[model samples]
Target: MTDANTTLPKTNSSPWTSRPFHRQYLMRQANNLFDFFEAPSLNPKGGFFELDDEGKALSAANSTRQVHGTTRMVHSFAIGSLIGRPGSGEMVDHGMDYIWNKHRDAKHGGYVWGLDDNGVTDGTKQAYGHAFVMLAASSAKLVGHPLADKMLADVTEVIERRFWDEKVGAVREEFANDWSQITTYRGQNSNMHLTEALMAAYEATGEKAYLTKAERIAELIIAKHAVPLGHRVAEHFDENWVLDKQYLGSEMFRPSGVTPGHALEWARLLMQLWILGDKRLSWMTDAARNLFRQAIELGWDTQHGGFFYTLDWDNKPIMREKLWWPVAEAIGAAAFLSAYDRDDYFQIWYRKLWDHAENHVIDHARGGWLSELTEDLKPTSRLFTGKPDIYHALQACLIPLYPATGSLTAAIIEAEHTVKQHH
Candidate 1:
């Protein structure tokens, strides 16, 4: 029996709160890291390097080895920008020097974008790749990492000089090894994602330039990409902020279905901007709420109870599938909304998210999550049956402190367990 009151929890520790499932994931990530450092084998007996057909990262390979994107995203949480303690061992990258790698292409500016078939940094770099670097570096700064400033500065210059669409005042898709911008229609996913990274960067450094660019692009996400009445965002855009109706590629997984995570990330960014006192984008918060409810109505699985990976705008079932990232973003929304304590209408959504994460996705047996489950809450991707470093774990780490969840003690206990595994 839990009470649904708005009283904030009095926590002495950091803002990151956790639960059983989060603790399990944290432990799995930790054990997996230990396994990577301690275990030595050819394949390493884990699925950390599973790549989608298009070379996008899929999941962790083994206990110690995490995929390139997974490693970057997990660092976002551990670097302590949003919801965790800072300056910890979970950050020291033995997998690959994500921050300060002299071995990779220095001309590329961003870290090596991919690992070779034999486990070395491949030289190609993508805009999305640099975005993750900014996010992780900003988070590292929040945690008192001495190198945070350098990480933030290096990546910021790379994006500003290379990815920036000077005509439209935004970023493009990919860049050459020498930081030359790829002349193609940009991806709204990475653009939004880069804005998100910029938001964190602004929070870390209080640099007016970062915040200013982030605000302009965030407005573009609304005016340029966001469809007003339809409650959907354009997944791709031209340099002038026009919607490219011929949406192709996994720039967003748009060809698959409506991605809930992307929308939520925008919502949180809007709120963060609001906190920064950029009230010009305040209307976007309501728009963000509309998208959030759109996601809840369309993505939430009624019988099985979890979010579908993709769905239609009118609450219609397109794929009716589930993915790890959307659930993670949904967790982000619930936590951010919990801080608002506005009308009591939002509590139900948070409860549904908590209920689903606890019951279906978390694997208490293996000390992590199953990674991917179907709309009916059955397993889908065995690639991450063990704990994989992912954005989901970072998002989950914040759920307990939001005050919407009933037990602070439980969340704290879970955070404690998670940090123990990581530290």
Candidate 2:
């Protein structure tokens, strides 16, 4: 086995922790990721780029604009701008224009699901997309975009009136075009993203309401759902918020069984929530640690070094193919847990996960990252083709640079401002 202290920043035999050297290392990796995606990911018309297998821009004519994709680009570049990356604001503006002009439903209140050259390909109003819009707007607000606050308000109002279920602590799943017909299905996937967006919104606006809503959702996922289910979050639910274990709604979004990626992600988010809020939530800390532990134990491929995409209820690998996002989430989870727990296992996992990313996931030639790879680590496009967005990978690379309290963008922004003041 490798000596864990060899990778530690300064200490000869201590586990890795956040020091100046560690910060510099993380910054370098983050910049490498940011620089690669900043230019290539942008579409010439406006919004972000989606490339073909050859690393060329996917033809605009055939390309359809997805609400989540565009919003993710906006959020990613806005983070870049927060960290003083040049031209990132322009990219943010590009995505904002697309959000306002193409994605927004003029007749209806909320954003549409997809758009193409003909416009409005999939007109469904989804909480998943709206959550990302909130995230994008929150990041833009931090960067002082002209339309950010207005956009944030518009989305916030729509989410409150349409998506937020007062009786239930989480957002609803999907709605019809006029926002009249709501689905019977409830989903933790959308709510998970909603929890993430609410945290960002709280940080951007200091609205206690947003934080309160976030905490409720976190409790639903972490306490009600995951903690009782052996740390496996139930992805689908009925109208009454009952678990739908047999549900197989959407192949990508609502697949049956548990997604280890979301489990690891919630673990990371739970810690951030604990730190951001009262910091007295001992249950939150325990839940976070347990979730991380269970996820690593169940989702990690014992034969291979990467995480399985999905695990059956029996803890068997349902989807054997490894994707980039789970490892990215695992990296973020390990980074924060290592800092919080000072556990040597997390430190070991941190090093191992980064090594796996550097060796297998990173697209050194194409710029961004390979979205998926086979179990043997060969490149595969079955799940995702080319690089889509930088949100997960960027956060994984940057979040380790700061203490585990706030949004990655906000933390980086504050750290930069502190350094400038000191200088």
Candidate 3:
């Protein structure tokens, strides 16, 4: 229940930000996650298995692999490899091989949405999935995976040729397998993630085009849309790039009204974009602040110490259930905002958010972070079943360990180089 604008005395005593012990704690948490997901996530049939609550594969033979889950495993394990974790390289290799051999549409030229042992369960090509594909490729490239270059090139082509709508400076939402039946529904979630992938891709390849596209998406989404709405990120839009306030597609992905988690996510991404663009886009920093403010102001459940999943146009909490990713993203955003402005407010929130995670979200007895929780912060699986994701929690632990200026991969590389030089 801390006010976003509550001015407090500046203090440099945040243990999470300054202490060596807390740094080690962060690394320990990260490595625990890597150890948790690295084994069971690998599916011998093809892509990753959806893990159950106890960190076991839910199904091996008949499990369906969503593009986002598959790609996230690749991306997370690549980070593991970069940090010199054992068996991480093989995890990356397995994901790369599966992506190329199984997920990639050999006939259709775009990646499929879902696959199983019988093959192609859902053939719709989504910008959201493709964004994660780009992310996996870029992370794999950083780890020196042999297939990274080809995969990156292919996904880039698919995104440009099919998804990228130059008229609006953002990618289109979804399409059918044969590149037909293009959906007229436009969304900010996919585009936001694509901005992340493009930045990571730019870091991997030194491609200005990728960075430029990322900048365009940031401007289109955050500056053009969210800024006008008091920094509340509108989730759904129409083909004409107009806001579709009444559009409610899915409970998991496309939900009604505003998503505070995405606002928290954009706050972090906008700061990274600003830093990567040499801080030329000054408006990005301001936008990041406002978005974070709005999210905290409107989304935070003051009584429960967690963020609400969704909010209405009136800034009322719609889905009051708490989820893990938003708290994770809030940690990341607060870390960057604190680093940039040296404000005690951000620093205080950074610590408080992590405290919340340690208390409620993270399954200390188990392995991965719990996905869903009730308003009072008890574990629940109403929306997400089992512990199927490591991306958000991993980033929450790792992003703070480095400076806020670049992609986590780049920051990892730079840190390694500095370590070797000093030695």
Q: List CA RMSD, all candidates.
A: 7.7, 2.5, 1.5
Per-residue lDDT of 85-179 in model 2, one digit per residue for the tens? 88888889999999988888888889999877677789999999999999999999999999899899999999999999988788888988888
lDDT of 2 at 202: 94
Each candidate's lDDT (Cα)?
A: 0.55, 0.83, 0.91
Clashing pairs in 2: 41-49
Which residue runs of candidate 1 sit more than 4 Å off their true CA positions?
A: 1-87, 93-98, 102-104, 117-122, 179-183, 227-229, 251-257, 278-280, 312-315, 382-388, 399-423
Question: TM-scores of the models, in the given order?
Answer: 0.73, 0.94, 0.97
lDDT of 1 by residue, 1-423 (tens): 122343334451222334555556544453433333222212232213433322223443422232345345435334332333443344333322433653235654566565534443445566776777787676666555666677778878878876786667678776556655555666667777777677767756668887778777776776555646365666666666666655555522334335666676666666656656455556766766766766565556666766665555454665555666667677666666656645443555565565676687655444345567766777775333333444455455444343332122223444566778998
Q: Could you tell me how far off, in angstroms, the CA of residue 305 lies in candidate 3 after the best superposition?
A: 1.0
**How much lDDT does candidate 2 score?**
0.83
Candidate with the greatest lDDT versus the true structure: 3
Local error of candidate 1 at residue 294 (angstroms): 1.4
| Arranged by TM-score, best first | 3, 2, 1
Error in Å for residue 220 of model 2: 1.0
Q: Give the per-residue lDDT digits (tens) of candidate 3, residues 1-423.
A: 364344554464553766898899999999989878888888888778988889998886699999999999999999989988899999899989999998899998989999999998999999999999999999999999999999999999999999998988999999989888677999999999999999999999999999999999999998999999999998898899999999978989998999999999999999999999989999999999989888988899888789999999998888888999999999999988998885567777887798899889889998889999998888888889998699999999999998677888888998899899999
The TM-score between candidate 2 and the true structure equals 0.94
Ranking by lDDT: 3, 2, 1
